[model samples]
Target: MLKKITLVVATTLLVTACGSNSETAGSGSADSGQSDKVYKLKLAATWGPTLTPFIDASQNMAKMAEEMSNGRLKIQVDPSNKHKSPLGILDLVKSGQYDMGHTATYYYKGKDLATIPFTAMPFGMTSTEQQGWMYYGGGLELMQKVFKPHNIVAFPGGNTGMQMGGWFKKEINTVDDFKGLKMRIPGFAGEVIAETGAVPTTIPGGELYTALDRGTIDALEWVGPSMDIKMGFHKIAPYYYTGWHEPGAELHYLVNDKAYDKLPADLQQILKTAMRVSADDMSVRTQHMNAEFLAQMKTEAPNVQIKTMPPAVLNELKAINDRLVGDMVNESPMMKEIIESQQAYQTKARNWGKLADYQYIKDNQ
Candidate 1:
């Protein structure tokens, strides 16, 4: 009887320990669901397959996310050519047809006036200052407010530093030169140009050269030297003017709200970090390419003449820009809020920039 009693006790202890071990294993499985589950996402971009820096931002972000997540997160990017919806990225992401999208915010101006300020403003902050406002000056929060209602989250994808005004077939010597001018411009800048008695139109990247070559547009403002060189605009329009409209043109990445919410906490953080790293890389890479290509312009396009718009013309354009923006602020409360925030931040940042960057450049030159 004693031996039988001891055997029963030992058997009970073994069963109890086995139960405890089973519970621990269940807890580990729960954690593994959050940490190790594989997520595959699709991204639709507004750019063509081979457009560098623009396409590079999306590609790099995908690559970084996969590596950072150790293959648990995979993003596949589809270019405009394959998707056949270059301008429909926002809609695609919003409907969850695409998990993400890469495009410019200004493209959605017709959808929401509040979206316009996020891209670039005429006579606005430089790229560096704009980025500072974005990361530090409550810009990101404001951006979320604008996007949340659409079931999308937006982040800065990349920036093309101060864009050139446009390539004009004829030189703009005075404000009168804008009269009846047909120019390819976009966003608020298009409105400002229209105020100058110019007909402003938005053309896709693929059709710009054909449109310009065939006299469909008298002038067109693409990007700076790096992008424009490949477009062969210099061969057609000899006059290359300086920038004003898009001082800091920033492209955006849009995330589907539902898709993002479904991600584990660690994956969410990883995705955000990847976006930031890739975006910064694109900004610096763009500057490097622009510098390198600008040097080659003299040899490639001998007829290309770099011209600055006249002071009188610039002053007139600025006045129009201010009036139009003021009108927008009055029209929409959201626009007013965003513009006020940006203006306040720009004022604080501009003062320091003048003392530091502007003065340094003036002194150096």
Candidate 2:
């Protein structure tokens, strides 16, 4: 009777142990399955790996996205060297070869004329004004409408507050100085410059220094001191003109709509948040760097003379710019809508800005 009782107890203990092990195994497998799924994305940047602030925006955005998503979202950034399509980033992402792209919207003016104003127009809003307009003044909606046809969702990537007009090999004193001159400028500004009898060409950023150095191009309008200092433009071009073309040049991040849609809702929010935060980061970073570098240029590069176009010359360019914009507005109702929206916002914002910022600066200085 004692032996039979012990056997029964042993059988019960084994069954309970087996059941516990099975449950543990099942739970572990379930948790592993949920955590193991990762979405990998590819981004093509118009900038090379070393381009500061510009490249920094995309890299910072990727880092933020991965951390916020807790490793579930991974973005691999490919610079112009790897992608070999500096100017073709919009097409690369739109066709799905790349999940996203980092570039300036104005670069694709030939593709769609309506895309120009999303970036800085000639004598357009300042950086703060543009940001306000984009986030609050319906500029973002217009941008989406322009990009929708290409299956792209665009976001502001970064902004260079006020770009310098350009670096010139010779001092431009009169309107005739631009005659027969070849310049590397882009967007509506390029068209405006063209009206002055100057030839305007858009060269890839990586090739700009070489183009200017080899005399392939006579002058080029890169961003201000922050980037130009690194490119060593001041070493070659003695004349650095003040900005009028791109008052607040903004770059854009272009995402493939399908790829963006595939993201889980939470991850979608994370992606956009990352882009916004990183873009704002770049703007501040650029301002800091520009201030530091501009001071350095003044002290170290004495030969690099800062210049502004004569009033007559500027008036001519302005007239030409206004006429070209009118022509484009007539060509596309969409263009008319965009210009009207921007102009409307600019008028309202500029009024406040003149008092809030412009007057403050005038009084302080």
Error of 2 at 205 (Å): 1.4
Per-prediction TM-score to the true structure, in the order listed: 0.90, 0.90
Q: Once model 1 is optimally superposed onto the true structure by TM-score, how far is the C-alpha of residue 288 displaced, in angstroms? A: 0.5
lDDT of 1 by residue, 126-241 (tens): 89889988877777878988998898888888899989998999999888898998898988999998977899888778789999999999999988987999889987999999
What does candidate 2 score on TM? 0.90
Give the lowest summed-lDDT range of ten residues in model 2.
Answer: 21-30
**What local lDDT score does residue 16 receive in model 1, on the 0 to 100 scale?**
43
Per-residue lDDT tens digits of candidate 2, residues 1-365? 99556534543453343243221111121123345568789999999999998998999889878876789889999999999999999899999999999999999998999989988999898999898888778877788889889989888888999999999999999999999889999999999989889999999888988989999989999999999988988878999999999999889999888888777655666677677777877898899999999999988899999999999999999999999889999999999999999999999999999989899999999
